[model samples]
Target chain A: MNTDAATAASAERSGSLLNLEAVVVAFGGLQALGGVDLKVWKGDRLALLGPNGAGKTTLFNVIAGDIKPTSGRVIIKGIDCTELPARFRPRLGVARTYQKTRLFRGLTVEDNLYLAQTGRSGRHLALLRSGVDAEFRERARAMAETVWLADVVGVTAGDLSHGQQRQLEIGMALVTGPEFVMLDEPASGLSRGERERLVQLLLSLDADITLLLIEHDMDVALRAAQRVMVMNEGETVASGTPDEIRVDPLVHSIYLGSEAGLGGADP
Target chain B: MSPTGAAPGRVQSRRTLRRLLSARNVVVAAATALALLLPLFGSNFFVEFVMTRTMILGIAAATIVFLAAYGGMVSLAQYLLAGVAGFMVGNAVVAQDAWSKGLKLGWNPWVAVLFALAVTTAVAFVLGALASRTTGIYFLMITLTYAVIGYYVFGSITPLSGFGGITGIDPPGLFEDHPQRMYLALVVLSVLVYVAFRVLAVTPFGLALQGIRDDPVRMASLGFNVSLHRTLAFTLAGFTAGLAGVFNVWWNGQIDPTSISIGPTLDLLIVAVIGGTLSLEGAWLGAFVFVAANNYLRNLPLVDHIGITEARFNTIVGVLVLLIMILSPDGLAGIIDRIRLGLRRLVQLSRGSGAGPAEAAAGSAP
Candidate 1:
């Protein structure tokens, strides 16, 4: 309703690489995702920004193969994953983190990393013989250390703080080396220190790891994502470089509004 | 020292399951060793009767534990699978009236037993598949329903079952009809099954089941076919139960549809619950409790007066189930774990106080 120009700047980068040409999804009488055409490349760090009711997460669900688009294709690495089951998407290197982070509540943090690893996943007999694969454990240890959670390996996932859980969830996704990782509101429940650490972590990741993040915080979204996609009422309103979308007359009232939120952040 | 002689002992108790030579395993192994050595001092009747029966029944209940612990399933039909062999073998052995009503597949006793296992496993696999999609009460109901169907089918299928119970089903002569000798055979079967399940409980796929138990939706999103893995867990459970069934027939030398009936199934569930749903050793202890309780209850004077005979054991069983469900939601194993944890904490606290107040307070601070 407010930032029409902010959405208009969304360069028509969609409908080319990871094509979702005119995708739509509706549940009962409610339209959740309406005719979205998004094209994402290998290095694209795109952010989906909207109010609480906007279908930012609904779009992430579509990309992660959790839900099927109503008459739209989802191609990953030129493989048509539109109708593939939820499990196969991860194998195709598409990973996701829930807005409400989901870690194995009962298992230790290290075991969570073990479960996330996609190695030695055969029959019971073979698993017994091979044990935990050494290579995967090494990879997991590296991922765990990167998130600054090396000390909490013995701690259960449920024991970790909310901010720590967020870090752990991201570490889990990173374990699999997903080609496209979709994170839903990583900055949602974080404190200032945690948010700063998260931003640094995002900035430190390799440019080749394509990220599609959804955050209501414009400042976090702008700092982390190279391009931002603005959604209003289940449709992409705008997509453009963070700088272009920031000063747009449409984005001003939509995101920053009368007040640009705490600490007078520039829109 | 609350003036009770049953005050806590100073000897350290092993609570954690992490240690290789912990108290639990040591106790279990020591008891098993005692059982194995019992035949030397005991009368022929003691060795021939109780010890023999304990090992045989132990094998049966252990099979049930494998499913519950690793797969996180409560299979009520485990004993029914074993009963198929039991009644069939018994009838073949004792059919003295005229001739035993053998299926006349003309196979050797061992071959016939193996065939029975194969058929039962296939049926169980199909049942497991149907029930695998559901969880909690719904899954339990599905498996229980199948147990009823199995019971009914074993009776009505006259082509294999005939009008009466299976007759002329004799156990093969490996034990030479010696009950104590049969105990050795049973001990072998029990050990094999235990080792097989123990190896699996720590394996990756087994850990996957734990993952599913924690959060199936998360597991699915992590690139796993949750249903398929659960079904496999069920099938493996069925397979072990079927193997136990083979031993059961040899032990009993009988066959009847009642082998797969609800009574035996419920017994398996009871054994699994009392043992502890989490650990492999839980079921072994559960089986010991089951045998001991059954023997004790049958001997009580009121069993006859209250109609709690072998045939009418349900009234008593229902009470026991209710008590266990209330008192031990995580079952006997969980109860034991809590006590051990309490002891460990006490020891830790006592040691901390010895270090003095200020240092002790800081050392144990969260």
Candidate 2:
């Protein structure tokens, strides 16, 4: 039964970029995720939708190698990285932004983006400034422009407005040029205009990069993502294209009381 | 477009020019120049002894500041590392007097200095490796434990440290003959160290260290090996502390266990805190304050009237430190920054009345 479920979940395994086989995570007696199986194909835009405490962020953490699943294999780019630490994720072309927006508050936006780039490629022990540093600086500037933070590139992350900080969080995640990007609620605190811009930015990303976004805003999530997966009580309740997930009765029932409508409504 | 009708490039250049001529920069430049020419005005006792002592202590305190401010590792083992270098210098170099019993390998002073630095750096790397895995209070405690262990080792090892410590150590001939030249060399070294740290603060590694300081978990997720970065910072601080140690042994003409004890360790930390743990320049300012207070504060008529002489010197320093902390938690550097900001505001206010609001807003944008 378990093998059948695993095969069923990862049926399209030929072009799969990320595969989670029987991933289970438990915090003592409470099970955060119970035997979850998932497969993300290359260039896939998958939106993970779930209510509060539904194990969406936990799955992202496990995939990002921040938290090792209690019992399961996390295969990314055909490599088994279940036991690998978070620092090794960059080598596998994986980047993730935290739900709480973890940023180096004391550093400027440019420095934050530059550090994200350098952490993946540049030597951490190079004491002397070099020509390569100039290239990284230029790339950081380009990323700032990409995130619509060009005007405030020199401002410290801590001093930025909440919307701007969220934008910068996305910028840092994308600066490393990872093949797979996971954004946990990138529009959590953004204004309506900023949210629209963020959706546009998400749509404008390279088609070759796989994106897994966790968002509560049905409007932003449905508009940006091609595929949608719904999780409830640490289990996959439903998975389908954006349109199918919107019309599904189970999704409506799960989200109706809390979110009111599955249609593009601002929740 | 700027209201001043200047090109963006020209505006940037103008801002840079303004920064170059800012009040703080002018004051710093003037002070550096004065320090370089201090020997001409001051008595030999003041210039040679007090000034040189301040520079040595300043270098030591700078290591603590570098580790704490940039790396966020408040290490108390900096002085112990310096003491290691001093011990190496004493053991490796030839003693001037026959009464001193040590290895006395009679190596060249410069060579011995290099050797001492190498040893100190190795020890620092080892200590960093041990303590980098821990953070906050645990890191402080582990480093403090190392300092205590070092003190005991130095005190117990009579063969190398000698009963009273390896004394009769002689400086190179150039410094030994000319006190002013020695002081000037120290000044030059201090400037170099200061500039080196400033340049380092903007480098990729330096920025990464600061990132780790601000958020180690975020840094780790970004693929930075947080522990390795912390360890490397500790090793670099060790090298700097070693530099201070070599100079200190030369200046004092000896190496003793008392120098690395818990008391002196705390004293170095106090110096760093008083100078401003966030600024490198605070190291010297703090050291100068500490050295001056230690030397002259007890001689005041007020102290005599209070019936507290040199025996209560620490009490006087404690009160001063308490006052400074109450006034400015960031230390002297914080006070200086506030004063500079106040002066800039005053200047802006005067200019605002003449130029109107638009230009004032642009000027105060930063």
Candidate 3:
């Protein structure tokens, strides 16, 4: 109801692609997101790092429209999409992969990408026309190749190794050609080589598509993201360039003081 | 670099149906040819009464399979949907007015059947819309509740269903007094419905429905409206059920209150599950099993020795259903798939490491 032109202008002028205004998520008495405010700018590769109970995923859920905030506004491109369900967000150029690999397991690698590509752009299917047209298959194949899955396009996602499944998860998110790609812990369970490949892949993504990811792997996260935001106890404790957050005393205490410490950081 | 080492046969089953000249397609074609020619070569009693009834019921059961297998919404209202068409047919043809037995339009059989189908489809959509919000057992419960309401409302309500229910409802002049012609018509209609279902099973809608079935949340994240897909699948299922309903009334020559009871409703689910909810062939298989059990099991000499008369046919069918549920929860389809997979493995072993597409195709027959 409050569609003020001034507020809209400020958000655009600030280069904010997503603006979360006083977003608060509460489960019974426990507040998962305690009045969090954040701005994700266009073409910004932002990494969200936090301790286990720091509400990083909760915040991601709120932005992704998977969870409704108790009270707040989620503005995407100056449009208040607070009430819009998660399914509608993809049309608005938002795509996300889950914390755990959520690829369609029964579907082949090509089929998974095919569904992702069609999710946002494809029209309501014609009854007689082939569901996966030549153009569609080509697009899916190209995407699979981009994700280093070209050779296994015919294989089911469930049969893929954990690392391959992760790659496929990212591929599924990117296949739709969304403006914002939110990946939750993309490097969580990969081998060192796989993580390095993942870092390279993230870095090579088109700059037009902004990236927001949550990662515990400090090395991978710092290498991939331009900016880093560390969360603690349902609040943004630190926000700066990756280098700045690396040396921030508050970030050190937050990381080192908690059970998930710097000692566990990947070499 | 294979993501999955298993053959492509698993995913291909849903899509392979499109190839008209494939081995599976050829087998289906041959079987259809046999079914069509049966009325000519076989006795009128077998073709007209038995096969005709089985195909009609098979079509109805297929509707259940469509919703259960693709949408993962195991609805119990498909038979109720068909019964809607039956009651509509009765209201249109035999009964003249509310003053008579039912809403007496006294229309021609063709017009009546069409009208009944349309009304049934609309009702199905309405039922779908209501049930789409629920999933799994909840969806089943909602549909079962509606089924109960429909059964009682159509059967016992004298105002809507005429005093003793509309009787002597016959097909058009072309089918009347011509059992073989009616059987042929039913076969043609049933085959057309099955073909349409097969075509739909390979379409985008069908694929999307399968995706939703696998992971509704994941499908939703991919921007597919899970509820909308479920509803549309249910409505499509309704269309087939309506066609079956029309044929059922034609076969029975009457539409009574008992025609839409819980017993018939449960039989629809039983037939579908017994055959294998995932395969289109399962519908006909289940129907054949059901009809055979009803016809022959009741008259078995063992039944008299067991102190169960011919009237207790359902008892035998019930036992068979229990056996199927316990032994193979996926029904006959699961059993058939396992057997095919085993044969493929055996053949590959016998050939000493030569695993060709031909062997794979032979294994994927079901």
Candidate 4:
């Protein structure tokens, strides 16, 4: 995944603690991101929106420290972490879930959560005589239950059903205790009821935790996010409340298939 | 398949066994213990020639297993890495100017060994970095290329004044030409190497390496620099192979182009794969089978009866590899572990199914 140049740069400076400014990125002649700027305060649930190739996912990549931008700076929680590596950013409390989910197929749910925790890497399997492992296991189980994964503690993340895997992905991101959490298409491949349950889960997620999410399902985004930034042609064309975005002609033109397949996005 | 009872024996036997000692662990421990004591009660000739060779080869194979089983890297260059050590020793004792010519020098054998090890570690790092950039068949191709180039370079290089490969390379004699004394020295080295590897196998590095083999992308997304992990594994494996190389010179009392050639490299692979690439002892077993069989085959009259010759060894090896591949992906270790697990399950059935069962097994099951 390509990270935002601006976000990655700030992450490099203040060690990714969170601020991104006027990030611009392009691929060949296509402007994937154009002077896009956003500020994420702690506990703010921000939603990024746009039609295909609008650079919605590109924004997620930028902030998650996966892809470097053409130019930009990202500061996390007042710390500059523009150049921090993906693993190092996590130590500064940044974590994200992929649109299709990325979990260890061979590792069980417990390990999935365990690996996702943000801290200095240590030997988790080093046989220790101390009782510290008990505390760690308890903490991991509590995190698993928070995402309703306790019943399937031993099930591999790869073997879980689509909805369960999604839940496991969220649980893993949470285990890291990241101050800023970003998710791309978390509602994908979910039944209606599963989507509703996921919405509820997101609403009930811990306070003092910031979230930036991208979803094509309008209903889920409306319910889960406090604000929506509508992207068009690799730029934020409109920013407003959910109700405001619902009736905005520009938002409708891009998302409602009213543009007759605009942006060169083939059906 | 029965949901309750009378399940297919194949499926039933596959049910895992989590005991005080796992089958794999038991096999590893027993193998190490047996090898450790072999020289103790054996005859002097056996101790000097056979056991010494076994320990040296065992160390090499063990290191190979470390890479194959844990790192999931199958390469033909491990012997070449070992060859790095041969020349290191060659520099120390073979050339009159070797010690004088080399960058760092000391007449002390231990320092020479350490110097050899340092060189090997550096080379291993470079090789590992290159190999980690690719995957699957590309890795094999890269390693094979290294083997070919390393062989020719060692044979042709003149700055070292190569004479059909450096000869007269011998570590300072610890026992004044006493074979039994040499055996003791090798036994100590082998035991130390084994313990070091065993400790590392259970470390964070080992787990991450295995994770990469199962799924590289997942490990990478989890913030692991997957390429770095792989390169590190290759480096460690190379270092171990290099250690075996220096020991090889002492075992044979000579170092030559053949020392670094593809012949020994393939032999190392045969030892590793036939023994079973899933466990640490696979290489040891594979080497024993090939070395012992080749020796026995040489004594037979098959050359007269069937026109067999030295060339037949390659075909014979090919046949064994094919059989092992078809019969057990786990190799002999897989078969032995299965049987041991089956016996444990039978005993458990006779009693009652235990509370916590198997901890979700270690192997990747179908």
TM-score of each: 0.85, 0.92, 0.91, 0.78
Off by over 4 Å in 3: A1-14, A130-132, A258-267, B1-23, B95-100, B356-366
Per-prediction interface RMSD?
A: 5.7, 3.2, 3.7, 5.0
Angstrom error of the Cα, residue A267, model 1: value is 10
List of clashing residue pairs for candidate 3: B95-B104, B96-B104, B97-B104, B101-B162
RMSD of each: 8.5, 4.6, 4.6, 7.7
Can you give the lDDT of residue B158 in candidate 2? 83
Ranked candidates, highest TM-score first: 2, 3, 1, 4
Ranking by lDDT: 2, 3, 4, 1
Can you rank all candidates by DockQ, best first?
2, 3, 1, 4
Tens-digit per-residue lDDT, B1-366, candidate 3: 212536667546544454456655676678789889997688777788778888898899988887877678888998899989998888888745334477777899999988988998889888888888889899999999999999888866786687788777878788888878877787787788788877775566666777777777877777878788788888888978998898888888878778788889998899998998877788888898888777766566676788776677677778888899898888887787788778878987998986575443343321
Report the C-alpha displacement of residue B75, candidate 1, in angstroms.
2.8
* TM of chain B, each: 0.80, 0.90, 0.88, 0.81
Per residue, candidate 1 scores C-alpha lDDT tens digits across B240-284 of: 777677666665555677656787787777767777666666776
* Model 2 chain B lDDT-worst window of ten: B357-366
Chain A vs. true chain A, TM-score per model, equals: 0.87, 0.93, 0.90, 0.84
Kindly give the stretch of ten consecutive residues in candidate 2 chain A with the minimal lDDT sum. A258-267
Instruction: Indicate which candidate wins on lDDT.
Output: 2
| Between candidates 2 and 3, the DockQ winner | 2
Residue B108 in model 4: lDDT: 70
Give candidate 1 misplaced runs (Cα > 4 Å).
A1-17, A119-125, A129-132, A252-257, A262-267, B1-18, B41-60, B83-98, B298-312, B353-366
Query: What tens-digit string does per-residue lDDT give for candidate 3 at A88-195?
Result: 888768999888777767667877787776666554354655545546767888989988888778777788898899888888888888889999999877898888
